[model samples]
Structure formats: structure tokens, C-alpha cells
Target: GENVGLHLPTLSVQEGDNSIINCAYSNSASDYFIWYKQESGKGPQFIIDIRSNMDKRQGQRVTVLLNKTVKHLSLQIAATQPGDSAVYFCAEKDNTDKLIFGTGTRLQVFP
Candidate 1:
């Protein structure tokens, strides 16, 4: 499926600042959630994940939050760095156990 937006949203942040990337998922029954970071010429790498039973989960400098009520998911990157500059995607597994990914959001960390 497609993301909620028509165009890929971009989140610009300072090198040491925090970055928040948001995604609105379509399935209310989605039980699993994941946040992925994809650099140029590479596949998406796992950043963090949150289960439907939990509201939040943290990994390294990244955090994933899930709001089942609104079917919204968000990824927070603390102390963003130049290496954090990339396309981030949010995915969720619905009742069918199929993973559906969002359009993606580009995170640009500036000096």
C-alpha cells in the first residue's frame, strides 16, 4: 500500500538535534511495527520496533512509538548526526501478516 502522503516528506535537523519522523498507518489491526533507515544504494536497516501491546520501544539512539487509537507511528532520533541522513520508513504487519511500508521520509542532518 501507499503512504498517507502523496510526496515523500523531508525532516531537516541540525547535526546534534533530535529528529522526529511520523507515519500514519492504514490498518487498525496491525500488530507489529518497525522503523527502518535506508541509506543511498543500500537496503533498509532495522532501527527499532514496537509491538501493539506496547506504546513505546527504544534502541540505541532511536525510539519507536505506536498509537493504536489513531493508527499512527513515529520514530525519534536523538542527537542526530550526519550518518543519520537518509530515508526512513515505517512498516506494520496487518492481520494477514503482511508488512506494509510507508512512502518514506528523508532525514537531512545539517552541520
Candidate 2:
């Protein structure tokens, strides 16, 4: 997966059993959604994706919920561990060359 950034800061999360990352999108016309995970200093890895027509999408222990009516979304991780710790992000695209992404969520692994 490829991530496009525009000089934004980062959001941090502590290591734990589970974590919930929230995202709010501006484009109500957007119909595509994807959640990506990026480990320390690495490229964003595809976690899961959902089309606008779907309200929820899930992947190995991860779930992405889309609220099309309000244009809000969230990603939930289960049994979060050290190795599972990473920055998570949500993206949306609507017939555009690039997908818009939130700042980022960095999950810290505490030993």
C-alpha cells in the first residue's frame, strides 16, 4: 500500500489489549474506504478495505466501520500486542488520483 502525506503530526496510542482509532472524513460523496497499518519507519500496509456500499469491513482481528450517513469511520484492533503495535490510518477516495488520510495513530509497544 502507498500513503500520501501532507506534513501533518502524529497521534500516539499506548500498547494494550485493544485499541480504537477514530477518523472523520470531510467528503460525503466519497464511497471508498481503507485502513492501513504502518510499522516504524515503514510503508503503510493494507489492513482492510470497504466499499462505500458496505458499512463494515473486517480483516484478521481488525475491523473497519463506516458511517456513510455521517461520513465517520473507525478502526478497531483486538488482542493488541507489541508486534501488533503500529501506526494505523484511514483513507478515502472518490475518483481522485490520491486518497485523503487522517493524521495517523502510532501504537506504542510497552515491552
Candidate 3:
């Protein structure tokens, strides 16, 4: 089965800088898109999501953008902080309605 994957295995960002995480999927049947943040010892926390019908969606300090034509997705974090450091994952709901996740990118925030 095809799955989603990240372009970068790790992303290094300075504190207070904006961070962008990229993901790609091969399945066009994916409808719902979600971004998740996972800390070292905790489960993945939902950040934001966008439906297939929508191109973009925004949260408090996060934005999720979906490009159905290119099968691409991105998550942008505004004013990234140290606490925002974690492994970020992009998930998509397949045709079967099962949530499929990417390989995940580790967000390293530096002061």
C-alpha cells in the first residue's frame, strides 16, 4: 500500500522563526488531512486539519495547507518556540476512511 512521506527527515529552526513541514502522498483518494505534533514521551496531538474541498486552514499558531492536484501538504508554524520542538506528522484519510500517516519530520527548535 502507498503511504505518505516527508521530504525532510529533520528540520532545524531558530526560535521565533516560522517553520514549515512538508509531506507528500501518492493516494488521490485521500480526503481529510491532519497535522499532528508529538513530543518525546507523549502521543501525537492534533494541530490542525483541512478537508479535501478546502485548500487551506489555520489554527492559533499553525496553518495546514492541502494541494490535491499535487498530492502535497504542508504545515506552517508561526513564531516557533522551544516548546514547539517535536516530531510532526501529516495524516490523510484514505478512500477506506483509514487514517494514514507520513514518516514524520522532527522539528528542532534552537535558541
Which digits, one per residue and each the tens of the lDDT, describe model 3 over residues 1-111?
A: 122223548899999999999999778988888988887667888899899999999889999888888999999999999999888888989679788988899899999
**For each predicted model, how many residue pairs clash, with residues at least 3 apart or on different chains?**
0, 0, 0
Ranking by TM-score: 1, 3, 2
TM-score of each: 0.91, 0.80, 0.90
- Looking at candidate 3, what is the lDDT of residue 111? 99
Q: Positional deviation of 24 in candidate 1, in angstroms? A: 0.3
Q: What is the C-alpha lDDT profile of model 2 across 1-111, one tens digit per residue?
A: 333333434444456566778888889888898888887568888988889998888788888999988888988888777786667788998887489987776665564
The digit string of per-residue lDDT tens for model 1 on 15-111 reads: 9999999999998888999988888777888888888999998889988888899999999999999999888989999778778999899888899
Question: Deviation in angstroms for 50 in model 1?
Answer: 1.1
The alpha-carbon lDDT assigned to residue 15 of candidate 3 equals 100
Stretches off by above 4 angstroms in model 3 are 1-8
Q: Give the top-scoring candidate (TM-score).
A: 1
Model 1 compared with the native: what TM-score?
0.91
List the candidate 2 regions with Cα displacement exceeding 4 Å: 1-16
- The residue-level lDDT of candidate 3 at 49 comes to 87
> In angstroms, what RMSD does candidate 2 have relative to the true structure?
3.6
lDDT of predicted model 2: 0.77
